[model samples]
Target chain A: MANERMLMKGNEALAEAAVRAGCKCYFGYPITPQTEIAAYMSKRMPKCGGVFLQAESEIAAINMVYGAAATGVRAMTSSSSPGISLKSEGISYAAGCDLPCVVVNVQRGGPGLGGIQPAQSDYYLATKAGGHGDFYIPVYAPCSVQEMADYAVKAFDMADKFRTPVMILSDGLLGQMMEPVVFPEITDNEPEKDWACTGHGNKRRHNIINSLYLKPEELEESNRERFKKYEIEKAELPEVETYLTEDAEIVVTGYGASARIVRSAVNAARAEGIKAGMIRPITLWPFPEKAYAETVETAKAYLVVELSMGQMVDDVRLATSCKRPVRFFGRTGGVIHTPAEILAQIKLIAKEELK
Target chain B: MKRITVIAGHYGSGKSTFAANYAIDMAARGEAVTVVDMDTVNPYYRTADLGDIFEKNGVKLAAPRYAGTNLDVPILDFDIPGLYAEGRNLVIDLGGDDAGAYPLGKFRQFIGLHKNECDILYVVNFCRFLTHNAEEAEEILREIERACGLSATGIVNNSNLGFETDSEIIGSGRLKAEKISALTGLPIFCHTLPDIPSCEGIDREGYYPLTVYIKNVWN
Candidate 1:
């Protein structure tokens, strides 16, 4: 099949990409900002010989995902912030049981059903264990509709490769926005799941999928094994995009939509003779520590921008080990900062640093 | 080409998608096209989201003040009035439902004066809820017209199952469109199909092949 170019919404594209990536089961509940994913799946899944089950709630949806993933079928579930909160317990179980699955959070503002609009306040929740565990799920933040489609497939692949859950952390802007995208040709060469809980035949022993371990030592061993994988992921899976940072005096950093706005801000600042560049972390989990450390060598100061009140700023600080001052600028509760707003912050930083 | 084309329908009727493709089509034919995003009710899918497509195709976009911003406020831009100026081909992508059509009531006087030069199209999709049949579609159409204080000049058959759509589905929609036309006394403006190689077996006039501009992110 040739690559086909089509215009799609971020949420719709994510659903289609999962189907094309051989995802056999989709369990999701409708929520604002992310409802299109469930809607799209409801239409496409059956046609593709896949399961499109809309569970009664987000809690049931994630648990259904767990069941499908335990059977070694590619499975996924998506929700917004409040819905994700409800699914946290199920997500923790999936992580602890070492099941491979993809979870999409088309985030909205929330300390509680804050608003049904774009927000990035789920950074801490997503990067740290969103569920109640010391486990880590590699979170991919996509800036464009194209990347939304790309990352959905990548999340599935990464999840299976590491035998853990992977998250595509998107916001309402990316979830709702549409863009032209070229879909990769579908392939049927997914990795085999040797430990899958298919009925154990005479050739193999039964595979039990459980998060609970009776003994403390056994649970500790499981934690140690997961941490070993996390360390490997930190070394292997960190992804970032840097623009004009070679001789930049000031580097603005952000992820997802904020990164897109920051790129425009950097361009505007450059035209005005301000040496501004950008470092966009594509994978929020690994934090792109090496990229930040390398850019800090040339960049004198950093501006951490987001759609929330400076959640990712902590990671940016730790990435560079506080080598230079990291300033924060953002709006919370569904407020989006414009490129002009970001450029003004960059200009202020340049003035202070150049002096 | 009509001087002003207003595309209106219920939610999920693919009105914004139709307006974007229509504007792009007009621009491709060398017309000076400007698409105004008059959608204030539905925040997610709107013509303003296609700014890049409009820019690339040389079509101007006049959107609401908070069209692409994170704010959920329904503040329309002041430049909206400029879209009604004569000479250029204009496409007005209205919001879904009667509530979405409320803003158009304010422009009723201007539209009424130039009604002959404007085309208010009621786009119908049988696949959508509250419009599964001709009677239901007609009721919603009257509601929208009453809200906007402007009568629909034509009916556009845009019924489909998104990417799952086929020629047979599109052909079946023509019957629903005919019923809507009969009940509303409106002419069939066009029958829309996804832009694919072969829409075989279904021979219908005004077959407008559409390149879907508005889509869910994971299409």
Candidate 2:
């Protein structure tokens, strides 16, 4: 019955998936659009023999995850945009210390607690820059509630695989929307954590979990080793979902919730006899440059859509290396882009290509 | 039918979606209906989110204070006593369980005065957490009743798993709802079905087929 199709909100599905994925510890604070994750964890975690802590604040919550993750336990924390900002320091420490943990940012609008509605403004923060450090977190953008559930499990696996913090970049719309989702089968395939800070009891060499490396040469070595791991991560990850791009003139692209709207618009354009296609990046950090490369010759121009003022647009341009013109259209402050509006942009691009 | 209908349920029980559709259905029947949203606990996907839909359908939506804005603070904006005194058809969409339904206690005196005219309906979804069984459903119903100081007159079997709902889900949920009905001695008002094509074989008796208004754009 657990695998049977059931309707669930994105937040609840993510929490349930985390539990099934062998996540032993969860720490979170209450915030709109993402409070359901904490609420679900409160009820389900204790029943499943997992620890759920509602820390005093967002800063406290992420530090709690850091402590739990150091002991080789699967620990995670979730929050909204403002709360994610508060957790940035802890995330940087996890990246520096090579502590594997999951961080979910079910983003709401923001510059300063902008709105309770959904927005995709945190692309740059999650991918290119997080806290003050030379680090990159694996960022996944899930488009539907089902993917929200699937990616929560994948995030934990990927985090442990690379021994780094993995970020699931969701938005308010995906957080609150309801859809039917089938949960994945539970597996106990976790790798042994010989580097964990578990008590040795005079049996073996004690493990040290730390982020401070004062020696300049030693820190450079640490940074270089981490960059080598990131190179593999970039090569192994970076998933993209493409639609009708073989002979297309204009390709529309977006990530997470905005990509759902872009897919609909691309379909509408195809129906109207325009050679429009879509390329949705499922991984934000890697940017899926290979997918863009495959379309560079066939697709004449690119249209990037988003819920913010075009944060992911910069990635599209860089991925294409300015070989094609990339246009950006977006709605900010929680206003979502309608499919009709995106279709109109595609129409304009199609007509201009005639010249 | 009662003049005032109050819908209460556990979290994610589809109460807001049902209340929104019920208000529109009443408006279609030429009733001057004003649906009041008192869900301050959970911010998103409440009746407040469908303000434009309600406006287009000729239904009045009275959302909470500071709703539809960036502020996360909870405030009851409507004058409940005035709405009760206005003599229009009223549908109050309460928040989940006792926490979200606590605001309804302020209008208890008005509702008690017109007890016969008020129909406090408890919506049930078997798939939701904390209410998967008859005993669990009764406990939540009693909690909501205690929080609002009113007894539920009816039980609405609104059991569906979003867009994946089908006739089999409806049947299984009805069986569970019937057990609760037997234990609590409340009548089953109606079984709600999502307006999907897979429900062709579903029985139409006492069924309320609804066009799901709150949906993802791609769906």
Residue B172 C-alpha lDDT in model 1: 71
State the lDDT of candidate 1 residue by residue for B134-206, as single tens digits. 9989988989988988999999899876655667667778898999898879999998887644554445456
CAPRI grade of model 1? incorrect
Tens-digit lDDT track of model 2 for A1-355: 7667767889988999999999999999999879989988988899999999999999999999999999999999999999999999999999999999999999988889688889999988899878988999999999998999999999999999999999999999899887788898867767999999899999999999998988989999999999999999999998889989998889999999998888889889999999999999999987799999899999889999998888988788889888999999999888898999999999999888635
Residue pairs of candidate 2 with colliding backbone atoms: none
Instruction: Name the TM-score of candidate 2.
Output: 0.95
DockQ, candidate 1, vs. native dimer: 0.10
Model 1 regions lying over 4 Å from their true place: B1-219
Tens digits of per-residue lDDT for model 2, B1-219: 678999999888888888998999999999999999988798776788889999999988888767767774788877777886787788999999888889889888888988898889999898764677889899989999999898999999988876667878898999998999999999998889878667767777778877777766663
Q: Candidate 2: where is the Cα deviation over 4 Å?
A: B27-32, B52-60, B108-114, B129-136, B200-203
lDDT of 1 at A95: 95
lDDT of 1 by residue, A1-355 (tens): 1363444668877888898899999999988789888877886888889999999999999999999999999999999999999988998999999999999999999788688888999998898868997799999999988899899999998999899899999999888765556666655646899889999877788889998899999999989989999999999899999999988889999899888889888999999999998999999997789988998788889999988988988898998899999999998788788888988999899888877
